[model samples]
Target: MADDIREMSFEQAIAELEQVVGQLDSGDVPLERSIDLYDRGAKLKAHCEVKLREAEEKVEQITLDAKGQPTGTRPAEGM
Candidate 1:
């Protein structure tokens, strides 16, 4: 299950997290099931955060030259 979450792309993780939230919001789930869903939701949230951070780092690597033109990408910070 841990590996599954780690392999998920940002879109997949966010979709699942939204589903979990909807389920929990409905108040139809049993206590034990709700606890399980919450745990998975937390993991999904963390994975999404990590993916966003990686994307931000990559976007920050764009190197520019004179005339405000993009030259190329440099190595991302904190790689």
Candidate 2:
């Protein structure tokens, strides 16, 4: 993955991935370009998965009080 891709937010990565999928599905890109797009799409998908995992971990960190109110976030487990 390029450094630029690593710096992209999840939304940006997902948008580009969707565009790449659309282009590949259309079957109009030349073979070389299709290969490049597929590679980029794979990287974008991985990045998105990592972002989602981070989000899920954060969600799991929410500390609840006796009344089930959110008190604060605890450290992510097994970090």
Q: For candidate 1, write residues 31-79 as lDDT tens digits.
A: 9999999999999999999999988776657788888789988777775
Q: TM-score for model 1?
A: 0.78
Clash pairs (backbone) in predicted model 2: none
Write down the lDDT of every candidate, Cα atoms only: 0.92, 0.91
lDDT of 2 at 8: 92
| Candidate 2 CA-lDDT value | 0.91
Measure candidate 2: CA RMSD.
2.9
Which portions of model 2 show Cα errors greater than 4 Å?
Answer: 61-79
- Where in model 1 is the C-alpha error above 4 Å? 61-79
- For candidate 1, the lDDT comes to 0.92
